[model samples]
Target: MPEYGPQPVERQLPTEEARDLLDLVREMARREVRPTVDADEEAGRFPRDTFRQLSASGLLGLPYPSEYGGGDQPYEVYLQVLEELAHASLTVGLGTSVHTLSCHALAEFGSKEQRSARLPDMLGGGTLGAYCLSEPTSGSDAASLRTKARRDGDEWVIEGTKAWITHGGIADFYTVLARTGEAGPRGITAFLVPGDAPGLTFAAPERKMGMRGSPTAQVHFDGVRLPEHNRVGEEGQGFAIALSALASGRLGIAACAVGLAQAALDEALRYLHQRRQFGRPLADFQGLHFMVADMATQIEAGRSLLLTAARLRDSGRPFARQAAMAKLHCTDAAMRVTTDAVQLLGGYGYTTDFPLERHMREAKVLQIVEGTNQIQRLVIARDLLGPEEG
Candidate 1:
């Protein structure tokens, strides 16, 4: 497959500094992430040291303020770094992306005092964070969540279970969304919950088909007390905050999907040139050449969609709908591209001997997480027609 996108109409080309940063990140991924990912996935081991290294390299807070010890780069630059990281190791890329979403809640909605006190530690990479929004009964319909938080004198007592929490048990802090008033999106509020807060506990991590290196669990909040100051924004603003964060998050996932698809294409192309059948290289076979062509075409189309959405974000435009389209298209492309890559490898693809099978497994989760593709389509359609259509 050709494995490159058509020229983007709205390009987010890196500046000189951003390009340097990407080069450094790419070098690190090649040196550190590439070699260890296979073993880490097999053992389901989270690479704490690698995360620490990434933090020290200023990657953890790439787009945040420099005052908080971040690199303060643009989203365009930040996402490309994420792409390279994902191409080398999906686990690290996912963890980084989730952590970034967690930070986005605080950065965008936090009071000055809240940002000053918490952003330093969180953005500095000393404390990893997670966002708690999904519930057992509510995944896509997040506003229908039942988790409640009632004001009690000087504190709010939070009570309920948050499902599918990435870094549930291991994160140093959590950005929790809970129902604080009536019975819909308008009643929900966001709060910053410390990891050691009383009455907070984690269910055992769910064993998954892929992305096992990123821990996920259900978090129970039973009368967890938070000082009034911990609230992220005005009451009833949680849904907006979450939606905004997710818009950006969708772009991150789109970038990751493109990176994965590209990796699969590159691997397949290399193998085709080397692996032989019937006294000739596989690439020489006209039948397989057509298959490669399809894979490349899909990957490029995915890239075109993803970059278009990302540029909308960089240009400060309302991009939620575009982001949904990008996430849906790119992730679906990744699933197809990786699956075909595995098939190209024939019997060896089914084994753990190569990364194609692992990539295929990893691609499935991208379709599920962030938002399911079904939800993404709904989001796009609602925006295209009108909010009343929702």
Candidate 2:
């Protein structure tokens, strides 16, 4: 562990307000998140209080409109805020991203009435959210989900299971994607299901290598009913809405990856400067110096890619390809940098004595989530080369 803790990141913010936001976030991270991270992560304790605090501070809905309790901040600023949160504790960071993703379909496509009635509570009323898309048999092939939602008069009866739900049982609301019509992607539609909805249940959280404090569980909807107004977007628009949310969601993952990698790099540098070997500090070694340089370079490159994609999104431009690229590059770089940090620390890094091992484990999930790196490559190639001819 670094004696001074992780250093503050130097940011190129868009405005004075944004800068103040970052400063406030750093203070929260330092005061609320970093101190208890090790203990909570070790115990697999979810930081529900921290999330409530984030909601109270207006941090939960930074990128959404202020009209609905959001901060009205741009994506660029929001992603940076995610990075800082991740740097302090990945559970907080990734949880914030997932919560934001859960709000997307409603915020973007729901009717004005829906927005007026639901958005305020979802955005900042201390309610946590989960996005339900992938099912037991559907991961990367999300369009092939088997979840069914049949209409009965004005209500939709949802019967299906959602796998890998981040907030699962604990979420106050869930933005769920379920089949409502024919089959495949077009048949799918989104719904905002209340957490206390009858017939809704959650499996126990999955045991994972890292980010254990953030629960990941299977959400089961056994004929849960929702009113007609609960549907988000059109009856056959769920897949489109999911894809749109994921495009921006990928950038959130990228920012979190960069933040995790930066944390690793900070730890490694701290170790290098303090740990002495053969009558000299580890920092004096040329080999370790190059490693640090490479780690810093990768972090910078990842930050630039994600920020570029975020700015493009903020400007109302097409950024799906850039988001994929950023997700792929940044997660891969986090994997590399975190592993390198472990190597720099030798046996200490591999053990729970240092955070590097946790960083390494956490970085692996980033590469796989929000679409795997393989999926990202396919997405980027599709953007450039179009669909496969066969």
Candidate 3:
């Protein structure tokens, strides 16, 4: 019998270099991530070595400036890379997205001196980073975050807890948002806090339904201090910085969703052809293959939506609306496809012996993270209607 697995996605690339890069990423995913994802996820083991390998391969900073040790690829190419990684394993894919998000504030808003001093190591020197924006009390309402940074001569004292932080306890650095001026968005400021800072601490990772290998925990800054030079952009500018990062990050989530949906679809197709019912293969049934067709169509649609948004971002066009749409559609599609995949696989799908159940559980989080689907709808509405009238 022939083997059944995820085949390569046919992609249209802007250059031969981009095509080669995708090939490298696909090979890495097949060799390094797919084989052990099940065991590692079951064990709740974070793939630190895999991440180091990604960093060494220059994948950690694909969308940033080449002068700073980034790959300098456009978001178009970068997001496709994320999609392929996600097709292999969501933990790896989503982890990479969070790491890229963590670097956004500094890469886009930091001083040239700061970028020169820190970007090389962060981009490719095996360093991992976490983004800190949501507090224990504020998640979607990010502007209301309560973490504070008070100035004390040359150093700033930070005190508060950031909840739902990816790589919370294990990252090498943190891109933190803190209240530095008044209340609300205007008061917020961004800082680069070394993960080993004296007063920084983390709660145990959250036990979740899926993506177990990616740590999500609360990070506490108990009088953590940092020099004035660590500030990114300007004081009272963190909210804008965070929002900007999220627009791009939503595209990352969208790509991940498409990848995951594709994975589930691939598995469903493989099983259908191999499993027989009513004296014939399940795939021979018109109704069943029609379901598979819907799944593939959704995945393709999601992929196109994300790539369109990515190209918009790369071209300096406004993409927040499109990003929100992509995130909403792709994640919702993943949920539907994965659930249908389970139905197709029947009893076997519900068991740990198959990956369908895991895919279903993992798909649920994409709807919740990067702003909940409800939040995405609100964002889309706001863009369509202009800000809510007072």
User: What is candidate 2's lDDT per residue for 52-83, written digit by digit as tens?
Assistant: 99999999999999999999999999999999
lDDT of 2: 0.94
Clash pairs, candidate 1, are none
Per-candidate Cα lDDT values, in order, are 0.88, 0.94, 0.94
- Give the per-residue lDDT digits (tens) of candidate 3, residues 182-263: 8889999999999999999999999999999999999999999999989999889999999999999999999999989999
Ranked by lDDT, top first? 2, 3, 1
The residue-by-residue lDDT of candidate 1 on 153-266, one tens digit each, is 999999999999999999999999999989988999999999999999999999999988889999999899999999999998999999999999998898888888878888
- Residue 32 lDDT, candidate 2, scale 0-100: 97
lDDT comparing candidate 1 with the true structure: 0.88
Task: State TM-scores per candidate.
Answer: 0.95, 0.98, 0.98
In order, how many clashes per candidate? 0, 0, 0
